[model samples]
Target chain A: MPGIEDLYREIILDHYRTPRNRGELPPPAVYSEGNNPLCGDDIRIYLDVADGVVRDVKFSGQGCSISQSSTSMMTVAVKGKTVAEVQAFVRRFKHMMTLTNESETVDESVKLGDIEALQGVVKFPVRIKCATLGWNTLLEALTEAIK
Target chain B: MVTTLTEASHNMSFDSAVIRRDFPLLAKQIDGKPLVYLDSANTSQKPNAVIDAMANFMRESYAPINRSAYTLAANATEQYEGARAAVAKFINAKSAREIVFTKNATEALNLIVSSWGRANLKTGDVVLLTHMEHHANIVPWQMLQQERGIELRWVPLTSDFQLDLTSLTSLLSGVKVFSFTSMSNVLGTINPVEKLCAAAHAAGAISIVDACQSVPHSPSDVQSWGADFATFSGHKMCGPSGVGVLWGREELLEAMPPFLGGGNMITDVRLDGFTCAELPAKFEAGTPPIAEVVGLGAAVEYLTNIGMANVRQHEISLSSYVLDLLTNRFGDDITIHGPRNPELRGATFSFAFRGIHPHDISQILDQSNVCVRAGHHCAKPLMKIIGANATTRASFYLYNTTTDADTLADALDSASDIF
Candidate 1:
């Protein structure tokens, strides 16, 4: 569980306590929502993307710590990245979660910082969705915005 | 089981201290103390009778039942069918031919959707379910909705957790089937099955009750309830897992097509077409869980000996005790879900602590050897309606006691402090 300590460790607690970019980014902008009704995880993700880059990203939702913290980390990770990079990061993060056969090379370089604490989630198969809710929502928002 | 334990130590009666010994898994320490098991609603622990029934079946009658001519196969088939008869009698069904074996309640539900539902429900036919149904009851119908364009509607829960039939009058109109759970597994709400069935019957709708929660803890009579079809699992009672039952009306069974087409379900097969077997067998394909069926029959006998009335009384009493203890101990600090009155509930009680996550609560409780189910428990929409992300649930059975309630309260008190 070495990499796992990165996913569930205390630093993630700090992000959960004081989530960065945790709110709406006005109406004329990107919007997306994701809900894992099973665990009552629902989130509304909004991003203010200017040109090809995400100028801002934010989320607000009610869920367990794993979901809320993961959302918070997702906002932090995707705020400054390009739409394509955010999608790739989300794809990689989901791969890390499912740890399925295809997701061999995870986002090893993108230091999610304390968000890495969620790496422990791979062991707990069921909670993987909770750990990646925000990232998924971000992807959805970007997908809609691109279209 | 009772005999050996009684022989080892002359103690009988439903005492928590003595009953805990019956559960072999209860011996291990969880965190630093005795583990408090609280998630029986999702899946109850196997008592000695259930475990022994399975073991005895495996050791003594280890042959495939039905569709064979061998002597051992005959005995196995008879015993397996005898179990089906036992289940039929348990639920007051007319005959064992109406009981189709399944892996769990989920498959039993799928059988209806795949067989009777697919054939009977046309496009635009509405499938009405309650909002409090477990995912098992909801998802299969969702498939019908997705694939066949069948309309799906939910009967919302009353403020106190039971179905509010009064509010769903319009929704019931034009509905072909009224499928719902007899009891909420997460909320522990004991729904009024007769009233709901009466409503559905009046509306010219077929009723399929998910009696998985109620059948194990209380006596169920499909005829008495007037339900078109009812489903439950053996393990929820004193039986082994991997076995479920679908109690349908003989008319429905005789009419519905086979869900899984395999060896036993067909009487004859040609390249162009095939004829179905008989009632229950037609629905049950492949090799059924013969040993588990036998064990489930033994389980039915075990529950009958104890008496279903006694089991219900014991569980409701325990639930009241648990409610009293939780209300007194945590008060406003924790939010207990479901009705306040014990008469409205069955064997489970779910609660969420303020300023604490249910996962954290379960993790802490586990340290004290208390096993509790945390999270949405597959009742996510219900959780949303209740305004909580997750909850820790404690369920009851005939074997549980006031002292176990006390131990749970104490450990939860500890969990409260820790979280």
Candidate 2:
């Protein structure tokens, strides 16, 4: 059995308490909102993509530690990466959170880093939505930006 | 404005410890700790009586009902219809024919909006609903609005979380159907059913009561409420899932078209068309949930034995204890939504703690085996009104005791420690 500490890791709490890239991006940025209707967790992701490079990314929302922290870590991870790289990272992060089988292998190059702390969330199936709300919104914003 | 725990307990009619023993799940241990279930508003824990009744029916008399004439089939049909009679008597309906069995309360509400609403409401007709209704009550109306071009009116809430009835007459003025919940599933605010029903009647609108929250927790009489139709789920009332009751006025049910078109709903099916069956059967299409209804019958009997007055009293005392303990312990750190007076509310408590999110609070509470719900509780509009995105809810039933409240408080301390 996993303890409460496992779900709310120290880094996750730190990110939740003092989030990075917490505000909106400037104009010319594409934005999208995602909501976990059951938990009332709503997040809006803002993206600034210029010439295929991810120039800036920010998020603003109210959610639990997992979601807020995951979003904070996601912004830090994807700020300097290219649009294609961030898209791959999003897929990798979702895969890590929803680890369908223990035997399934994760690509080592798409490093999750601090976001890997949220792997414990897979145990609590209900909180997986909380952990992924920000990432899903980020994905939507990226899609909107390319369009 | 706070009642003492001693006074509250003294006023209660039954001992919760004794009632707790009737439910086997109350004895369950989670993570090596005794389970403290406080999510009765979501769904109640079933007692041994209901479990045994369902099991017994399956073993002794389970058969396809209302379609066969064999002795065994007749016996099964008798038991199934007997559940309908129990439901009818439970809600004080005029006749058993008024009770229509659907999959659950959601389906029951959908049945009304599709069947009765479609027949009566035309384009531009108004249907009034409250801000605090569950999605079951709201979505059905919204579906009708889009498909039939009907309009929806909302009755807002007061600052104290009760329904703001000052403009109710104006809200109901052009309304063809006035649908609302008897008690809020999240806020626990008990609405004035009879008064609202009268207002709806005076305005020439039919009243529909979503009694899913009220029927299980308190004494409910549809006739006394004067509601044209009332619906509730057996699962929320200590029975099994897959069965719910929709009690409509006999005349209205007869007048409306059937919601579903299938086997048992029709009396005669020719090559070209079909004639619908009688009142209850017309709404009850295809194979009904026979054994679940038997369990619901047993659930009603079990609740009757405990006495609804006593059940309501138990919850009142429990609610008082929860409010007193949580406030006294957490002080300004805690914020409980809804009326402070126990008389004005049910046992449901949706609250926030410090700055910790509801999911975190619920997670910490689960460590001590205290089960609570943390979400919008299917009332997004009400959540918006209350100024909370989500709230951690701990709802009590007749089986809950002050010890459960203590466990919940102790668990909260752990949550605060984590945050």
Candidate 3:
């Protein structure tokens, strides 16, 4: 039984309070919207991809701390990485989120960094969608950028 | 035993502690903390009478209803139809024939839209709805709109979250049907059903009241309300799930086409077409939720024994307590999104606390075993009107006490500390 402290860690709250890349991007940037209709969590991911390398990322959304902070953390983690690298990171982050038990270990190859704080979300299955809303939107944005 | 409990409740002043004892789940503890359930508007915890009735029916009298000629089947049919009678009496319908059992209130509303809306409404026909209706009421009409090209009109809300009916007559102009909730599930604002129904009648539009929220907490008289049709769910009224009631005027029900086609809904089937069954059976298409219906009957009996007036009185006091407690304690931090007056509302309250998102608030509240609902509450149009993506809703019921409200305030204090 993980407590509220585990889910709303200080790091997650900090990211929620002061989000990173919290604005929209101009033309030449691909964007995709993601919505969790169940909870009314809406996220729009704006991506600036150049020659297979992710140049920049930004997110704008209104949702709970888990969702908004995850979006903020997502923007920071995926920026300045290759598109493939970002894709790998998303897979790892989702894998951590889908883990039923908090004790479950992730693959040693991919490091989640601050996004690992959201692993506590797996304990609260309903909030897992909130934590992954941004990552799913990023996936959609990446799919659009590749096209 | 049930009778004694009911008599005790009726004889004594409204006591939530005594009422809470009837519901088994209220006794449950999470992480050594007592369960403070404030989400009765979502679905109520079933009382022992309803639970036992359902279980007893399944154990002894479980059989095919209205199909077999066996003694057991007759008994089962009697119980099922008895439930319909109970529901009819509960809402003061003219006859049990006016009541049609469906899967849930959503299904009941959909049945009306598909059957009556399709039969009566033509292209450009307008259906006036309120901003407070749940998706069940709205989406069915929308689906009809998409298919039939009918126009949809909305009755907006006042600043105080009540229906702004100042221009209702003008809005009711050219409207074929006026469908709205008797009580707003999100805002807890009680709509004036009798006034709305009369206005619809004067405008030559039939009124349909979604009484899902109002019926459970308060005494409902559809006849006095003069609503052409009314629908509600059993689950929200301390009965089992998988059952809902749709009560319509007998004449209107007779005129409408059947929504679902099956064995029970038909009188006789030929090679080309089939003759629909009479009145209620026309709408009841298949083997209905027999046990759940029995449980619903028990629930109705339980409420009747205790008296709906007492239930309403208890809720009114609870609402006043919660409204004052939350407002006075939280002050500028809490924003309760409903009318400040407790007399004009049910106990259901949707609120936003200190800019903290509803999901986070509910999550922290969950830590203290304080159950509440946090989301759009399936009223997205209302949510948009309120300028909130989502709101934390803590709905009280007859069984809820001021102690629960105090626990909610205490837990909210903890939420503020964490955030």
Best by DockQ: 2
Q: Considering only chain B, report the TM-score of each candidate against the true chain B.
A: 0.93, 0.96, 0.97
TM-score of chain A of 3: 0.92
Clashes of each: 13, 0, 0
lDDT of 1 by residue, A1-147 (tens): 123233446766677667777788886687998987655668999888878898887788776667888888777777788877876687667766764366355655765555556778777666677787777788778877777
Each model's interface RMSD (Å)? Answer: 4.0, 1.0, 0.9
* lDDT tens per residue, model 2, B104-183: 99999999999888888899999999999999999999999999999999999998999999999888998899999999
Q: What docking grade applies to model 3?
A: medium
For candidate 3, what TM-score does chain B get against the true chain B? 0.97
Model 3 residue B103 lDDT score: 89
Error of 1 at A44 (Å): 3.9
Candidate 2 runs further than 4 Å off: A99-106, B1-13
Q: Give the poorly placed runs of model 1, Cα more than 4 Å off.
A: A1-10, A27-32, A35-38, A49-54, A77-129, A136-147, B1-12, B146-150, B167-175, B414-419
Which lDDT value does model 1 have at A111? Answer: 53
lDDT per residue as tens, model 3, A1-147: 577777988899999889999999997998999999988979999999999999989989798999999999999988899988888788788788763345654455989888888888888999989998898999999999999
Of 2 and 3, the candidate ahead on lDDT is: 3
Give the number of the best model, judged by lDDT: 3
TM-score, predicted candidate 3 vs. hidden true structure? 0.97
